[model samples]
Target: MADGLARVREQIAAASARVGRTPEDVRLIAACKTFDADTVREAIGCEQMVFGENYVQEAKVKWPDLKDEYPHTELHLIGPLQTNKAREAVALFDAIHSLDRHSLAKALSRQCENQERHPVMFVQVNTGEERQKSGVLPGEADDFIAACRNLYGLNVAGLMCIPPAGQPPEQHFDLLAKIAARNGLSELSMGMSSDYATAVAYGATNVRVGSAIFGNRFYPPAGQ
Candidate 1:
């Protein structure tokens, strides 16, 4: 794991240099979804302070307990969030990278109003137009971002996207960068394990990596 992390870090540095940018310009968010606490702790030991999770329930189980052991780590909720879970998410996460609609934004805002701190959020754009994905369609990106910006208690930090699997990732990432540029937004969260290098070259501010860093995910038996 240590060797893998070192290699990944070197890759990130090299990719950043290739684009004429510094490594500091990109944030590598270790995606910890489906991994156990001990593995996550190992990642923390490697000085990886930013982590991304897909399931709210799983994160709730890991974050608080791990916080005492890894106090400096920042948790980002990068999953499809349910409106009913908004309050818990706002309370526990440092950021929500999948804010896809006005109602979800409003719910998060309301929850933040009572919380000690509000989480930074990004509007997830469905750049590949996947029917099963949770994101605002590309054409609706501007309106959705505008709506989020108008909401109270929510800091509209940037944008996030997951391009269709198996396709060349550069095309999707490039489109995302263009959209963000046109809207005057500075942040882009558009990379994952497989195509993160391509993402870096195309201007991804945050890359959410899981298997590339943690190895293959282990799922429990059918009934758990």
Candidate 2:
């Protein structure tokens, strides 16, 4: 685990430097979704304090205790968010990288009102316009972001995206960067383990990585 983290960090630095950008420009969010608290503790020992989780329930079980032990550690939600989970998400994550809809923006706003904290938000965009994905279509992102800002009054930070499988990811990254700039947004959550180096070369403020850091996710045998 230690070696894995050190390697990833070094690679991130190299990737950033390839484009004359400092490694400090890109924030690595170790995607530790199915891993246990012990896995995260190992990462913390490695001084990798930021992580991304896919499920709200899974994160709830692990992060609070980990945060209590390492208060500086930060967690992000990198999965599709249901409006119903807004409050729980607001309480658990420091930032959310999947704010994809007006309905969710409204839900998060209400939750923010009650909690008095607004988690940083990244409007997820389905750059390829894939039918099966969770993000807003590229055509609608501008209006959606505007609504998230003016109507919901949520802290709309930037944009996030997942390029279609087997496609060149550079264009997707470029498109997201342009959209973010047009909105005067600063953050870009647009990469995963496979293409994080490419993402850094572009303009990704955050990368959600998992397998490269912790190896493959192991699941129980069927019917366990």
Candidate 3:
């Protein structure tokens, strides 16, 4: 585990250097989906303060237990959030990276209002235009950003995206950076375990990584 974190640190340093940006400028969000608490604790010991989770239920189970142990750690919701779970998400996560639609945004806003926690949010953009992905199409990004800005209890901090698999992820990162720039947006949340370095070069403020850092996930049987 120490060796893995050391290697990840080296990669982050090199990647930051390649892009002429300080390593501190790029925040590494350790995607802890399916990883156990001990593994997350190990990451915390390695000084990884930001953790990303995919599911509300899984996070609800994990975060409460971990937060007491790692008080300074920040939790980010990096999955497609459902409207029904917005209240819990607002109460638990420090930031949400998968806010894609107006209805979800509105629900989150109301939830935030009730909780009195202004959670940072990102508008997910479907850079690859994948029909199955949960993000706004490129053409509609402007309107979405505008709508998010008007939401009272949410902070429209940036943009997030997941590029198509097997394709050069740089293309998607470049598109996201361009769109964010045109829209006067500052934050770009793109990239993952395999393509995070490319994302940094293209302008990713936050990178979500899982397998590379924590190794493969272990899932139970469907009935479990």
- Taking the tens digit of each residue's C-alpha lDDT, what string does model 1 give over 54-156? 9899998988989887778899998899999998998789989999988898888888887767888888999999999889999999888878777454688
lDDT of 2 by residue, 44-153 (tens): 88889899999999998888889899999988999999999998999999999999888889999999999999899999999999889999998999999999999999
Clashes of each: 0, 0, 0
Tell me the TM-score of model 2.
0.97
lDDT of 2 at 49: 87
Best by TM-score: 2
Better of 2 and 3 by TM-score: 2
Worst 10 residues of 1 by lDDT: 145-154
After superposing candidate 3 on the true structure, give the runs of residues whose Cα lies further than 4 Å from its correct spot. 151-153
Candidate 3 residue-wise lDDT, 1-224, digit = tens: 66766776688789989879887888889999999898899888888899999999999998998998888999999999999999899989999999898889899989887888888899899999998889999999988888888754469888999999889888889989988998788988998988888888888889998888888888899999
Candidate 1 residues lying further than 4 Å off, grouped into runs, are none
Report the lDDT of model 3 for residue 99. 88
lDDT of 1 at 57: 92
Stretches of candidate 2 exceeding 4 Å from the true structure = none
TM-score of each model, in listed order: 0.96, 0.97, 0.96
Candidate 1 Cα RMSD (Å) = 1.2
Report residue 8 deviation for candidate 2 (angstroms).
1.1
RMSD for each of the candidates? 1.2, 0.9, 1.2
